[model samples]
Target chain A: MNPIPMEQSLMVAAMLFSLGLIGLLVRRNVIFMLISIEIMLNAAGLAFVVAGSHWQAADGQVMFLFIITMAAAEVAIGLALVLRLQSDLPTLDVDAMDQLKGGDDA
Target chain B: MFWLTSIVAIVATLLAISRLNATHALLYLIVSFLSVAVLFLQLGAPFVAAIEVIVYAGAIMVLFVFVIMLLNLGPHAVEGERQLLPPHAWIGPGLLAAVLLLELLMPLSNNQFIPTTGTAKHADHSTIPTIPTEAAPQLQERMVVGPKEVGIKLFSTYLLAVELAGFLLLAGLVGAFHIGREEPRTSAKPGAMEVPSQEGPA
Candidate 1:
C-alpha cells in the first residue's frame, strides 16, 4: 500500500478551497455562499490535520479543534443574520439587499 | 493506496459544488468529508478523523441541511439560459491554484512522495493495530483512556473555551429564534384594499 504523502493531502485541500471560493463568488443565494464558507473552513481544518500528522505534532489537531469551534460560532451568527435579511428583503441576492440602507447590521 | 480514496473524495467535493441542487451538493459534501477523514486515519490520526466526521460532517452538516430545507431553496424557477464562467472571475482562482501547486509539489525532486517503491506503508500494515497505532500521538503510556481522556482534557485544559462555546451556542439559539420566528410583514388586513398605487408623492 502506497502511503499518501503530506503533499497530496495539501493538493486535495487546495482544490477544495478553490471549489468553495468559486461557489461563494459565483453564487447569488446567501445560503449557498454560507455553505461554501463552511467548505473553506473544513479544508483549512484538514490541512492542519495533514501537517500535524506529518510532523507528529498534536498541536495541529488541537488547532483544528479550535477552528471547528470558531466555525460553528460563525455559521450560527451568519445564518441568523441571513434569516433576518431575508425577512426584510424578499430575496437573498446581494444586489437587492444593497437597497436596504440599514441592512448592514445584518 | 489511500491516496486513491482521497482523490475520490476531492472529485466528490467538486461535483457537489458544481451541482445545482442544494441537497445533492450536501450529499456529495458528506462523501468528500468522509474520504478526508479516512485520509486522516491513514495518517495515524484516527481521533482527528472521528472528530472530523462527527463534528463537521455529522453535526454541522445536519444544521446546514435543516437550514436549506427551511429556506426551501430550489432550482431557479426561470432557469432558461445559463451563463458561462466570466473570464475575469477566473483570474484570482487560477493564479492561486498555480502558486499553490508550484509551492507544495516543487520539493518532490526525488519523487519519494509516491512511496510506491518502499516498505514505508507495508511495515505499518500487517503489524500495526489500526486504532492504537493511529492514535499513537495521544496514547503515550499504555493508558486505556477512552472518551474519558477527551472529557478530562476538555474540562481541564479547555474549560474556558468550552464555556465560551456554550455561550456562543446560547446566543445563536436566541438569534435563530429572533430571525426565523418573526411576525408577519403584511400590515394590511386580508380583505383590506392595497391602496391603489398613488403615482406621485403628495
Candidate 2:
C-alpha cells in the first residue's frame, strides 16, 4: 500500500477540528458541550500523531499521551462541575447561569 | 483508506453535534472517536490509536454517559434544547470553519509553501524500505515507531512532562472530590437547607 500523504492526514485533522468547533459553538447542553471539547482535543492529538508519523519521531506520540492525560483530568473536573451546576442551579442551560454582575449594575 | 475513515469520522461527528438527545450525541461521538482511532492506526501510531479507543471512547464517553444518566434531564429540557439552538447558531461557526479550512488547504496545495530543506528531507523515500529484504540493514535502525519507542522517549526526554501530567491528574482528582462533596447543612431547620448554596456567583 502506498503511504498516505501527510497533507491528507492533516486535512482530516483540520476537518475534525472544525466539526468539533462547530459542535462546541452550537451545542447548549452542558454534556454536549463537554463532548465537543473532547472532539476538539482528539483532533489536535491526531494532528500531532500525523506529524510524528511524517517525521518518524516519537515526540508526537508523547505529546498525544500528554494530551490524553490532560483530557482525562479535564473531563473529571468538568463532570464534577456539571454535577454541582445541576444541583445548585437546578438546570444545565449555560444561559441560565449569568448571576455575575459588575459593580456598575444596580 | 485514510479518506474513507476520515469521512466516516466527520459524518459521525456532524450527526452527533446535530442531535438534540444527549445520549444519542454521546453514542455518535463514540463512533466518531473510533473512526479517528482507525485514522491513527493508518498513520502508524498504534499505541496512540489504542489509547484513543481505551481512554477516549471507553473511559471518557462512559463518564459523560454517567453524568447524563445522573442528571436525568426532563422532557421539557429536551424541548427547550430544540428551541435554544436557533438557525443563527450555525452561521458564526460555519463561517469560522470555512475560513480555517481555506487557510489549512492553501499551504498544502502550494508546493512552494514548505521550505526546500524540509521537502528534500522527505523527497527520498527509497532509502526507507517498508518491506524487509535479505540484505536490508538492522530493523532497529528503521524509522518505524511503536509503543516501546514511545515509552523510551517518554521516560528519557519527556519524563518531566509525564511527572507533571501525574500531578495534574492528582489535582483534578482532589478538586473533583472537594467540589462534588456534599456540604454539611449546619442549620437544624429544614427550610434553611432550602436556600441555594453560594458558588461562582451564579
Candidate 3:
C-alpha cells in the first residue's frame, strides 16, 4: 500500500484544529472550553507527528510528549479552577463570570 | 486504512464537541483519541501510538470523568447547556471554521506543497532489525521509529525540556491543591466564646 501523503495528513490536522476552534468559540461552559483546547493541542501533536514521519525523525514524537505533559498540567489547573468557580458561582457559563469586567464607575 | 481512521477521528471529535452531556462528549472524545492512535501507528510511530492510548485515552480521560462526577452535573446541567447553545450560537463559529478549513485544504491540494521525499527514509544506524531490505524495500520505505530512538533523542537533546516539564507538573499540582482547598467558615457560632473561656480555666 502506498504511504499516506504528508499533505493529506496535514490537511486532517488542520481540519481537526478548525473544529477545535469552532468548539472553543461556541461552547459557553468552562469544561467544554477546556475540552476544545485539548482538541486543539491534539491537532498540533498530530501535525508534529506528520512532520516527523516526513523527516523520519523522532523529534516530532518528542514534541508530542511535551504537548501531552502540558495538556495534563493545564487540565489539572483548569479543573481546579472550575471547581473553585463552581463553589463561588451558580453557573459554569464563561459569559456569566464577569466579575472582573469592571467599569470606570466602580 | 489511514483515511478511514482519519474520518473516524474527525467524526468522533465533531460528535464530542456537539454533545450536551459532558460524559457523552467525553466518551466520543475517547473514541477520537483511539482512532488518532491508530493513525499514529499507521504513520510508523508505535511508541507514540501506545502513549496516545495510555496517557490520552486512559489517564487524562479518567481525570476528566472524575472531575465531571465530582461536579455532580445533573440533567438540569444538560438542559442549561442546550439553552446556552442556541442554533444561532453555532452559525458564526461554524462559518469561520468552514472558511479556515477551505483555506487550509486549498493550499494542501496544490502540487507545489507536496513534500520532496514523499515518504520517510530509513536512517543508516537504525537499531530496529524488522526492516527486511532484501525481501520488500518498496513496502517498508517509511522508517519505523521505535521507543529506543525516541528515548535516546529525548534524554540527549531535550533533557532540559524534560526537567522543565517536571517542574511545570509540580507547579500544577501545587496550584490545583491551593485553588481547590475549602474555605474556612466566616460566621462564628455562639459556642465559639465558651471554648476560649474553658481553655482559660484549663
Give the local distance difference test score of model 1: 0.61
Candidate 1, B26: how far from true, in Å?
A: 1.3
lDDT against the true structure, per candidate, is 0.61, 0.72, 0.73
Task: DockQ each candidate and list the results.
Answer: 0.27, 0.39, 0.32
Highest-scoring model, TM-score: 3
Per-residue C-alpha lDDT of model 3 across residues A15-102, encoded as one tens digit per residue: 9999999999999999899899999999999999999988989999999999999999899899988876665455678876775521
Per-residue lDDT tens digits for candidate 3, residues B86-159, read 67655534543444345334534542212211222333334354333442453356566767788898999999
Model 2 achieves a DockQ score of 0.39
Error of 2 at A95 (Å): 0.4
Candidate 3 Cα outliers beyond 4 Å, as residue runs: A101-106, B73-127, B130-139, B186-202
By summed lDDT, the worst window of 10 consecutive residues in model 3 chain B runs over: B193-202
Candidate 1 clashes: the total is 0
Instruction: Give candidate 3's error at residue B18 in angstroms.
Output: 0.7
> Of the true interface contacts, what fraction does each candidate have?
0.31, 0.71, 0.53
Top-lDDT structure, candidate number:
3
Distance (Å) between predicted and true CA of B139, model 2?
9.9
Q: For model 3, give the interface RMSD.
A: 9.6
Query: Candidate order by lDDT, highest to lowest?
Result: 3, 2, 1
